[model samples]
Target chain A: MKKIESVKNPLVKRIKRLQKRKQREKEGLFVIEGFHLVEEALRHDVEVQAIIAEDNKNIPSNHSGAGISLVTEQVMKEMSSTETPQGILAVCSLPRQEKPLSIKERGSYLFIDGVQDPGNLGTMIRTADAVGTSAVILGEGTVDPYNDKVIRATQGSLFHLPVIKGDIEKWIEACQTKNIPVFGTSLNEGTTHTAIEAQNGFALIVGNEGAGVQEKWLEQTDQNIYVPIYGNAESLNVSVAAGILLYHLKLFH
Target chain B: MKKIESVKNPLVKRIKRLQKRKQREKEGLFVIEGFHLVEEALRHDVEVQAIIAEDNKNIPSNHSGAGISLVTEQVMKEMSSTETPQGILAVCSLPRQEKPLSIKERGSYLFIDGVQDPGNLGTMIRTADAVGTSAVILGEGTVDPYNDKVIRATQGSLFHLPVIKGDIEKWIEACQTKNIPVFGTSLNEGTTHTAIEAQNGFALIVGNEGAGVQEKWLEQTDQNIYVPIYGNAESLNVSVAAGILLYHLKLFH
Candidate 1:
């Protein structure tokens, strides 16, 4: 056990730095706040570097293996990104996310292209988990899955699935090699989403909040489908659209 | 058009007060920040009380009817809830939210019970609007749709639909009399959502993120259905689940 009472401790500063994407990538580590998220990280085989607690009381009695550090309340608050510090947090190695060299035969996957909102990305990851997609591939300009807001919105499901960043072209190529059809949302052309028959496997691409699928990617999709807007709203939230589409395609299997 | 430079102006204080629920309720008004939101409020026919802009440049030249106030950048910053003021804001009359005494004939509706997250509530409202539901009834304990975060998350869909607050019991009873089936999500009991037939008119009730549909309400549902978890995630985000369910019914119609 280590006691870290000073707010200015070098270790506390280092832990606080993980809140930024650049620091997290540089250290190859990220911070998970609260008991539930930390526990999920441990349970999912993520390598926890340390458990930082405001006091020993905040640490679960069953917790073991990781070095425990007792920090002052002020120190914990300083390191926390949330307004109210949850009293306990764990520093864990980032998940080993790799672009798939090849896709599984007859397997469904989600390809997220340039979805920027952290909350939207998180919700989409959680939905992707619910549908049991083989994986989630993030295209360039997409929000990082490990971002704190995204992680919180995921509700611990980030640990339940594999989310990796890759080029859209490579992902499309990989899926096509496996004979998995690629689909995207396009209002101006192609079949309506509902009109398409449920398939055994496919790759679904969802794009930015402001922009639909990028033109280059849209051109390559084996099919482009649009959800009919039956009301005055111009479009559905990207994540909501993805959830509806992913489940529709996956449920039949 | 009126020009004001002081943050201490009486009218400026009133607009700032609209951020709080009690004040908003008493005044029957709410604050919407940003150019797009203000524009949407006008386009949707939401009664705009005033348009406040950081400078004359942010205001459209075609503006008429409502009083427009030009304020200094500092004053606008003080009145805006967002970190970066979008330079334009509007004070609008709150929508007439009330309990429904009768249900519409053969029209789809969404019933939200106790969802507390402003973002989730807002996203659900946007999804409900996209599906063209007749109305969205927010049960007791749900977050105020007028809350700033909720309003922002809704994009502009908050103006596109009727979102009313009411008792869950009354809503269920009204639906029953109109021969509309009330469906709920239950993990342990109920048919899988995919197995259930889509209907032209019905009420879909989604409960609190943590507690799920109250046991009492679950007992009253004409049918309970669950979205099967194909992965290790215990559940999907509530709004995501609602999105999947709402589109399922809407698509079939």
Candidate 2:
């Protein structure tokens, strides 16, 4: 039970640095705050490097054997990204999947392209997890999945599934190689999503909030589909659309 | 054009006050920022009280007959809630519907119960709008629809439909009077969403992020339904869940 009384402590400084994308990537670690996320990381056997709790807060019993640090509330506040810092936080090693993704014969997959909003990206991952998607492949320009906002929005689902940053074109090719149909969402060019019957294995690509699935990616997809807008809304929220599409493709015909 | 050079100008102060829920309710006015939302407000023929634009920005031509005010960049920033003020905003008379909501024979409706997140509430409204829902009834404890975050998340779908703050019990009674099957989402006590055949006209109620729909409300519904979670995630994001349920109930038979 090491005590970090100052925000200037080396360990505290390192945790704070992990808030930045570059620092997280360079060090191959990220910080997760709040008791729920910290617990989930430990439960999932994610490399829990350290558990930091504010002084006087009881560390969970399961944290036994993990490195623990007791910090002052002020230090915890400095280390936390949220407006209200939860008493507990954890530093975990970033999960690395060195092997390239292999599209399975009977699973659903989500391919996200240039989704800029962290909340959207995270919720999409959570939805993909909820729908039992095999993996979530992030294309270029997607927000970093380890970003605090994205992790908080995922509500621990990030630990539950493989969320990989990969090249979309290559992933599409892999799906094609496996004879898995890939669907791209488009506003103008595609048939309604209902037109595509649910299948045992499929990949659905949802794109940027504004630009949508890139023209190049759409060209590579086996089929392009859209959720019909029956009312005056211009389009569905990207994450919401992903949920509908994932559930429909995974569970229904 | 009238010019508002000071943040303390009565008009600027009044507009800023509208950002608070109390002031908005008292004045029956809300402020919307950014070109897209302001343009949507004008296009939808909403009661535009005044258009506020930063000095030197060209106001859109569609703003012809509306009251227009030019403000300094500082003044515009003072009146805007977003970090980057978009140079344009509008003070709109809140759309007031005096008559009670009458559930139609062939229309879908969304009822939100105690959803606290503004982003979730707004996104759900947008989803309901996309699904051609007749109205979105906000139950007690739901976030204010006119809150800036909620309005931004709605992406102008707020102007496209009736978003009423009302009693959930009354709305459920109205739906029952019309014999529109009301579906309340629950994790513990519902048939799978797909278990019930989609209907042309129905009412769907989704609740808070952490808690499912309230027990009292769930008891009032004609059916309680849940989207199955096939993976390790706890549950779907509230807005995403609404999108899935709205699309499933409205489009799939």
Candidate 3:
């Protein structure tokens, strides 16, 4: 085991940089903290570049195969995004899905467009995974899935399923081309989601919390759906809306 | 209009104290910041004690009848909970519902048990409101709904519906006595949520994030329901799960 005792150490500095979107992209690596996320990453076979633990913390026996480094609590805090460092963290390679997803596959898909809140994005991904969706595609302007807040929100579902970033327009076109119905959420000029029968496979697009699905993409969807607001609320939380729609589309064929 | 230029002003100090649960309980007052929330409170006919705004900010014309106070920007920041003060806030009396909810009403109700996350609690309340739930009953140990993060997450829905804090076990007994079926969520020994037919009026119980509904409550419910997880994700985010169940219970028969 290697030991890193200084916040000034290059490895610690590199981990700190992973906090930013640009840095994560530049390095093709991101940080996962806390015991559960680290264990999930290893269990799911996410490439573990290194497992960093605070000097007083014990690394799990199964994690011994991975390259391990021990660091002082100060050094751990320097690399942690959370207020209280979890004492264990991992640097894992971002998973890449080289193949374009096939809509003909027998599973639902979630496309997030310009969702800015990390918690909302993460919860949506977890919901998608819970419903056994095929994948979660991040359209341009969607918050980075690797964002620490977003990752924490996913509760390890980010590793359980494929989360890819791609062009929204292209994914919509692809779904339409393959005859997989694409449903975009809208506040108006659409049928209620309950009116749509379940499908073997489909794509659902949810948009920015404030702006909703873009008009251009709504035009491209086979059908635009809205959840009826029976009360005085202006709108449902984006992630909650996604969960309701996803479950309906998946379970009600 | 009273002008409070000092953060130490008695009124400013009192407003600052509204941030704590203890202070809020003692005063029977809570602080709601942001332009939209203040507007919503007024629109909903909530008892507005005072409207506080930054010196240069324009108070809405319709708000002229309410008591208004002008504070220096620094003073506003001192009383604000958010990173960026929205330049306006309202100190409103907490609405008290003296009568216990009747389950015989033709609407669903949400009972939350020990849900600790403010965002989750707020979003669930918003979802319940969106579905036209009769009311939201917060059991002991649930986060204070008036907490600023919970209030913000509600996006002003807090003013749109009834959110009462009470005993979970008693609420369950009340529903059963009224012959209104109560649904408790559990991970085991429960039918999938879809298995239950929708009802005209029902009570749904969601529990703590880590533990499902407490065994005592689950044992007394009409039926315990589970949302089937089709993928490897351990569970849905609590708010998302509540959204799915609420929509199903309200929209389908």
TM-score of chain B of each: 0.94, 0.94, 0.93
Indicate the residue-level lDDT of B175 in model 1. 92
Q: What is the C-alpha lDDT profile of model 2 across A20-103, one tens digit per residue?
A: 999998999999989889888888888988888985455656775678889888998888899899899988888765457787
**Whose TM-score is higher: candidate 1's or candidate 3's?**
1
lDDT for residue A168 in candidate 1, whole number 0-100:
88
Docking class of 1: high
- Return the lDDT, model 1, position A199: 81
Interface RMSD of each: 0.9, 0.6, 0.5
- The sequence of per-residue lDDT tens digits that candidate 3 reaches over residues B1-253 is 5578888889887888889999998889899898888888888888888888885355655574568889888988888888899899988888665456556556678999999999999999899888889889999899999999999999888888888888888888888787778999987568999888888889999999998689999888999998899899999999999999998877443
- Give a tens-digit lDDT track for model 1, residues B78-164: 898988999998888886666445688887888888999999999999889888898898889999999999989888889988888
Q: Candidates' TM-scores? A: 0.95, 0.96, 0.94
The prediction achieving the highest lDDT against the true structure is 2
Worst 10 residues of 1 chain B by lDDT: B94-103
Candidate 2 lDDT by residue in tens digits, B1-253: 6678877888877887888999998999998888899888888888888888885455666776678888889998888899899999988888776447677887788999999999999899998988888999998899999999999999999999989988889989988998888999997577998888779789999998888799999999999999888889988898998998888888543
**Model 2 lDDT vs. the true structure?**
0.88
Instruction: Compare candidates 1 and 2 on lDDT and give the better one.
Output: 2
Pairs with backbone N, CA or C atoms under 3 Å apart (clashes), candidate 3: none
